[model samples]
Structure formats: C-alpha cells, structure tokens
Target: MTQKISPNNYLITVANDRYANSTQLFRAAAMIHEVIHAYYHSVVDDNNSPTTNLSLNNFPALYQAYAQKTYPYGVTVAQHDQMATDYVVSMAMALQEYYYNNNPTPYPFLSYEVFTDLA
Candidate 1:
C-alpha cells in the first residue's frame, strides 16, 4: 500500500507477515518495488491525480515520454502506468536474483529460481 504522509513525502507498506520468512534479497527487492511505486506516485503523479487521463494532455513531459517509450501502440495512460510498474518490479526482482546468486554470503536456504517462479 502507498500513503501520502505529507505534502512532500509518501510511504509504502508491505505486510510484515509476507516477508517474515523471506530471504534478505527478497525483502530488499520487495521494498525496492514499493519504493518505485512511491516514486511514481510522488514524482509522476505528483501525489495527486492517482488516475491520469492522457487524452486530456495535461501530464508532464516525462510522463508523455514514458508513454511514448513503452506504449507507442496507443495504450491508455493507466495502462502505461501499469506497464511501467510491472517493468520496475520485474527489474527489481531480477536484481535480487543476481545478488542472491553472485554474493559470497552463504544463503543456501534461499532459492533464486523458486523465488522467481513464485513471483
């Protein structure tokens, strides 16, 4: 969940129970994913206008650029946001997998393949 705690700050929360038994990499990835959401909310959405109407053409240039970058096929603004969020989350998960596999720490209990499959 994402919450606007102040005019200039936002907070993202994940259920504690969800990560209680997860690996450090998994937890970090989850947090990073939420942070990406928060960043999109605060910077892209401007902490307001949760839903955007691209047809109105009132969004920032960055948002329009992103829409063009990912949804050149004429998707709605909401669809663009969803795609961006999925992309960010997937990238975070991939980074987590990379760290889990490359780091010297003995995280034998952590299974990157299982985590990716589950995700």
Candidate 2:
C-alpha cells in the first residue's frame, strides 16, 4: 500500500510481502526511498504545484521546473533533489537485488541527475 502523509509531506509505499518474511534491511531501504521522496518534494518547491504531484510522465517536467527556479544563493534546489533521488535509486537497487536474487533493480531507466532515477 502507498499512502500520502500530508503533515510529514511525503508518500510511503509498502510492498505486499509479510514483514516477518522480509529482510529488515530491505524494509529499511523502502522507508529510505519514501523519506527521499518526501525530502525531495519538501525542499524543491514551497508551492505545492500540481506538477510536484507524483506521476511517471510529470516527473521530468517537475524536476526541470524546480531546477530553474531562482533562490537566494542562485543555487537551485532541483540539483539537491536530484542528488537525493540518485541516492534513493541506488538504495532501491540494493533492495531489489536482495528481493529478486540480483536479477533486476528499480527505476533503472532514469539517470542520476533526474528525479526519475527513482521513479
């Protein structure tokens, strides 16, 4: 089950496996991905634009939009968010390795610079 937590400002998705049957590390990994998504959303934009709403097609536009915004230091939050997504994708890969016996990984299509890296 995947859910949105408004006050905390992130979404959490749970795999359909029994917790006891799963490796604790993978469970933690899933939580890490959720945390990354929340953090990415919170830091990149102050306004909750519909673009920030999570979807496969809208992710790239959202990332580019945030990356182009002007802030105090001239550093875009989009860069930082992309880094967070990269880290999450790496984590998700490890988790998928454990779950699927090293056969595949998650979000394998997107690059490290794009938030789609973990989408």
Candidate 3:
C-alpha cells in the first residue's frame, strides 16, 4: 500500500523487492530520485509559484534528467534502470562475498545470467 508522507509534498509507495534489500548505493540513489522528484514538483510544476507540490507532467522529464545525471559515464534510461537494479544486487553480493571470503565452505549458485543482465 502507498501512503502520503507529506501533504502533496511527498508520497510513499511500495517498490519491488530490489529496493527493499538494496545496499547503500541503491539507498543513495533512491534518496536522490525522491529529491529530484520533489524539486520538479515544487519548482517546475508550480512555476515557482511558492506552493510546494509536484507536477505529474514534469516528473518523467525530471526523472530522465536525473537518470542521466546519476550515470554520466553511461547514460540511458535502460542504463539507469540497470544501475538501480545493480545497486540492489550489490547488497546481496557484498554479503555473500564476505561470507565466502571468510569460510572454507563451498558454494552453490544460480544460473548467474540474472545478475549479469544489469547492463
């Protein structure tokens, strides 16, 4: 379910599992995304009207710009989505890497292509 975090200023919605278990990178990106959203709503939509609100029409354009800004090295909408996905996977990988690094136990893994597609 979704909830309003603030009066038309912010709304909270349930995201996919990726976001829920993301590492610091995803966390950071999520925060940035929200801020950019708010910025667009408050500034672009309001026409600098001084009322704090987001404009639905401006969000997609703002999101595109945000994605480009976040991944300037390889910028694209798909790339941005992949990066966001990677940020989540990195969390799981980091934990597993740490465990395997310390333990002598062998590991079993999945097909792994699922992870590599994040390009």
Model 1: per-residue Cα lDDT over 1-119, one tens digit each: 66778644787888989889997667766666566556665665552354654453445566667667877864255544573557655754676566767778775655555555433
**Alpha-carbon deviation at 65 in model 3, angstroms:** 17
lDDT winner between candidates 1 and 2: 1
Model 3 deviation from the true structure expressed as Cα RMSD, one decimal place: 10.2
Worst 10 residues of 1 by lDDT: 47-56
Candidate 3 positional error at 1, Å: 12
TM-score, one value per model: 0.47, 0.36, 0.32
Maximum-TM-score candidate: 1
lDDT of each: 0.62, 0.51, 0.48
**Clashes within 3 Å, all models in order:** 0, 0, 1
Per residue, candidate 2 scores C-alpha lDDT tens digits across 1-119 of 33446633555667565566875554666576556657655644433446555454555456555456643332235435555646756665655454456435562453333322333
- lDDT by residue (18-108, candidate 3, tens digit) is 6777754345445544544454344434443345364554554665577678866533444445546645465345444543465565755
Where does model 3 exceed 4 Å of error?
1-8, 14-16, 48-119
> Between prediction 2 and prediction 3, which has the larger TM-score?
2
Candidate order (TM-score):
1, 2, 3
